[model samples]
Target: MIKIVSFVMLIVVMLQGFTLESDYNRAHQKAMQSDKIFIIFLTEKECVACNKELMKIMNAKNVSSLIEKNAIFVVVYKEQKNTFPIEMLYTTQYPTLFFLDKNELFSCKALRGNIQPKELMNCLKLR
Candidate 1:
């Protein structure tokens, strides 16, 4: 009975930590280190262009590959979303890509519209 109880408890704890929201925060913290870059996705729910841009980024193999390796990817939903800081830091742009080096400085304007995977990959490399 004790063994089963412990196993169940472990499973519960692990499951709680598996969410994307939690993972995003953890990765964001790590990106503060010099070795990592942060690629933040600011999105609005009602924007058609934003949705299209997000789809492109999601399917972008090269961008995804680079992001998986050396960058922290954060998806922030704006326009009265629950995330206060994201709403404060960003605005109505449905899809915005904010790049930051390890120093967390604002590197460029929010990249909107459809983005090519290779272009995003090249941007990160330049960072």
Candidate 2:
């Protein structure tokens, strides 16, 4: 029983470790290679609204699939200044979205609030 419990615990820890790091630099590189870009900024560790918005977007299926097919998704934690991969795209808002092209062309604003997944998909699919 002890061995079995230990093995199960090990598996759980390993699985947890595989979660996405959301590193701006790595995500940006992936985005630059892709056809579209989806970048989001959350204020900091203490913002509940920001956390909820991030959770909603990250777990959103339509958003995730669209991102997988057409865009690269990035999450920026605002309190951490130097971690942002690109300095030119800074914002004062807690939750702001920057839609871009493969060449880093800033396109649209998909800010956090009450946006729905279908609406987001439709917006992204548009030219």
Best by TM-score: 2
| Model 1 C-alpha lDDT per residue in residues 1-127, reported as the tens digit of each score | 5346335534543343321222345556777753777777676655667656655565555655666676766655664334324433645444667776665666544566566666677767776
Residue 51 in candidate 2 has what lDDT? 56
lDDT tens per residue, model 2, 29-100: 776655456454444556666656655655676666665666665555665565553633455556666666
For model 2 the local lDDT of residue 91 reads 59
Worst 10 residues of 1 by lDDT: 13-22
What are the models' TM-scores?
A: 0.63, 0.64
Whole-model lDDT per candidate? 0.58, 0.56
Cα deviation of 77, candidate 2, in Å: 0.9
- Give the lDDT of residue 112 in candidate 2: 52
